[model samples]
Target: MKKEFRSGCPISSALDVIGDKWSLLIIRDMLVKHKKTFKEISDSDEKIAPSILSARLKLLESYKLIFKTKVPDNKKENIYLLTEKGIRLTPIIIEFSLWGNSNMREFNEIDDIEGLNSDKTLIIQTVQDNYNSMLLNFQ
Candidate 1:
């Protein structure tokens, strides 16, 4: 059977792929923190299980949000990096972060709201300035 979207709205289409709580967070980690390895993603504060992390990575790859590339020096592990389509989500993630920070004050103490706000803008601009810049730069 073929999968279907709930509606024709662009937002709906996007939500179909990334509406889940974990998927967006996975993308954020890859796009912002440059975390490529399964260990890195699994070890996040969310403490996503290895099995779930694997599934999310596969789903993201299927949607073309991310791509797997062989490590230049190490053939053992493949690095996951965001595609242009995925990088486009930086702003959305930033907005989500901002909203969460504002509404969920009891969650955690944000060191600098101003800095986070500024970083959000900067991150969005950086992604826009160079799409390829979103790719993993380190091992």
Candidate 2:
């Protein structure tokens, strides 16, 4: 799908595509939670509605962030796998999680990434490594 941006600013353009309510959450479900199929992605804590999930998946696909394929055992069902572009967002995702852990903790519980590493650099490296390994399946 063609996108219409309000401005040429880097942050604005990036947000124009992914700044919606459920876009980043969907990406986080795939990246950090390792959700692949429609069912799996829908089974997130945020409980996104089917209609909104469908639209966001299409938008992500149009942007080449993810690819959809039929499940080997179930052709009727599709598995949504992240592309290189999607995997490249791992660092940003981690940053959001850490920032939320720091700032939003007073309001909400967060920081599952702490299970991987308390050190920021170490956690980013670990998640990036995991994302790369996952990309191998697509390649």
Candidate 3:
């Protein structure tokens, strides 16, 4: 499928790829929660439908944000993992988390909000290390 951009604006171009809420949430799951399978991701706090989860996973893969590979011991099962491009999104997610915590009272109640709200660099590095290590397995 062709990736159709709506305009020349950088923000618009970015939204064209990772614009949807579900897309970002999927990235969050992989980066923050280390969720590697469809079931794990679908069972996230948002509870996304299987059909929607399948489509979003494919879209993320097409955009080079994530990839799916067979489990070394179980060929029948596939695991979704972040690419370098996707790992790069960690900072953005951290920033968003911080912003939400600051402005939204409910956001402040999220699991481990205390840790997520402190020391942005630490959060970014921790997620990057987790994802890069996973990527090494595929490489």
The candidate that achieves the highest TM-score relative to the unseen native structure: 3
The clash count of every prediction, one per candidate, is 0, 0, 0
Clashing pairs for model 2 are none
Ranking of candidates on lDDT, top first: 3, 2, 1
Model 2, span 40-120: residue lDDT tens: 999888899999999999999999988899877778988998887887877788788777767887887664554544777
Answer with 1 or 3, whichever has the higher lDDT.
3
Candidate 3: where are CA atoms >4 Å away? 106-109, 136-139
Please rank every candidate by TM-score, starting with the best.
3, 2, 1
Best by lDDT: 3
Q: lDDT tens digits, residues 1-139, model 3?
A: 4478999999998898888899999999888888998989999998889998998999899988888998788899999998888889888898888877677766446454547755789878987997788667765
Better of 1 and 2 by TM-score: 2
| Runs with alpha carbons beyond 4 Å of true place in candidate 2 | none
Q: Quickly count the clashes in candidate 3.
A: 0
Better of 2 and 3 by TM-score: 3
